[model samples]
Target: MGLTAEKRSADWLAQGGLRPTRQRLALAGLLVGDGEDRHVTAEGLFAAASDAGEKVSLATVYNTLRAFCEAGLMSEVVVDGSKSYFDTRMDDHPHFFWEDSATLTDAPKDELKITGLPMAPDGTEIAKVDVVIRLRRK
Candidate 1:
């Protein structure tokens, strides 16, 4: 990664109240260093880290992802009960899941319209709505 990207990653972690540890910096560089959003699974990130010569275990990747989500740096989009994708974009938006390829991408917000939603049960209010549109080729 370029020096500027590395500096941006460090700043981002600090803004999220996360320390810029070596592993965190490495992973952050991969995620947002390019100034482009990304959707990545834990396995995918682990592979990328391995290819980048970072000595991080799959469990560490998972834990780091969880921490990122907790810190509001990333959002977890669960496509199914078995798998989830971490999104670098924190905005409230829907996503499109390619079933065949097991990949996720942002759906067009302008094309989506949520007219109504059912009332939540007592003692709880709606936090956020996550829409995942699954797609598959014929």
Candidate 2:
């Protein structure tokens, strides 16, 4: 038989080296239950939890998202100084941020390329680079 959503979420969390607490299970189930990749912010996820009858606070959502990112289960995309999005798809890719709608969408990875990047600092190593193409109505 197939595993239930809760069970699957619990297993995933365990594999990610995270303890499967009640709040974690609930939030993880909501985030990854459908097996579809998604990008969401803390406020957006909190609204979703509220709509789904899950009693999760915004602060809890933020903390949980940070934990998930630290566990390598999700990726954080910062669009602006004040706005950040959590992406479920961890593979290397780019994103399109719609300014008017404040939405994020995946860009075609094969079509994007980076060149002419400056050298890293004397003692620092270059980490992964993220590209976010911003869009607005014409």
Candidate 3:
């Protein structure tokens, strides 16, 4: 069963037309091998790799994450411009950002809305809009 789940995730990446290399497969296993989604950064992923006893370079983690995002296996959320968090959920949903804890959570899709459309910049188009709602401790 464990091997089957891992293979399913690897195959999912393969179905996206991405080469499931060892590093990519290893990262994918950490990201979605379990039945739950998670928010992680490349640095966090590197830590996870260490915890799992997997040897992966930071550059490789970033590269594989970019590839996964491009292949639709993950979503990139830029809570802070300098740093970005990755989400394993591949659906159109907003995010709940806990500033104090530095965590990202899925917001109910129905609680979001968009109005007053703005014109697109020259030679650019809107692909997807990610809304991040921040929360604080009382």
Which structure among the candidates has the greatest TM-score? 1
Error of 3 at 127 (Å): 2.2
TM-score for candidate 3 = 0.88
lDDT per residue (tens digit) for residues 2-50 in model 1: 4588987997788799999999999999998888899999999999999
Best by lDDT: 1
**Candidate 1 local lDDT, residue 53:** 98
Task: Sort all candidates by TM-score, best to worst.
Answer: 1, 2, 3
Residue ranges of candidate 3 with Cα displaced over 4 Å: 1-3, 121-124
> After TM-score superposition, what is the CA distance of residue 41 in candidate 2 from its true location, in Å?
0.3
Candidate 3 at residue 50, lDDT? 80
- Comparison by TM-score, 1 against 2, better one: 1
lDDT of 2 by residue, 34-97 (tens): 7778999999999988998988899999999999999999999998877999998999999999
lDDT winner between candidates 1 and 3: 1
Tell me each candidate's TM-score. 0.96, 0.93, 0.88
| Cα lDDT of model 3 by residue, 41-122, tens digit | 8999999998999999999999889988898888899977877999988888999999898888888899778875688899
Regions of candidate 1 where Cα sits further than 4 Å from its true position: 1-3
**What's the CA RMSD for each of the models?**
1.8, 1.4, 2.1
Candidate 2 Cα deviation (angstroms), residue 67 = 0.5
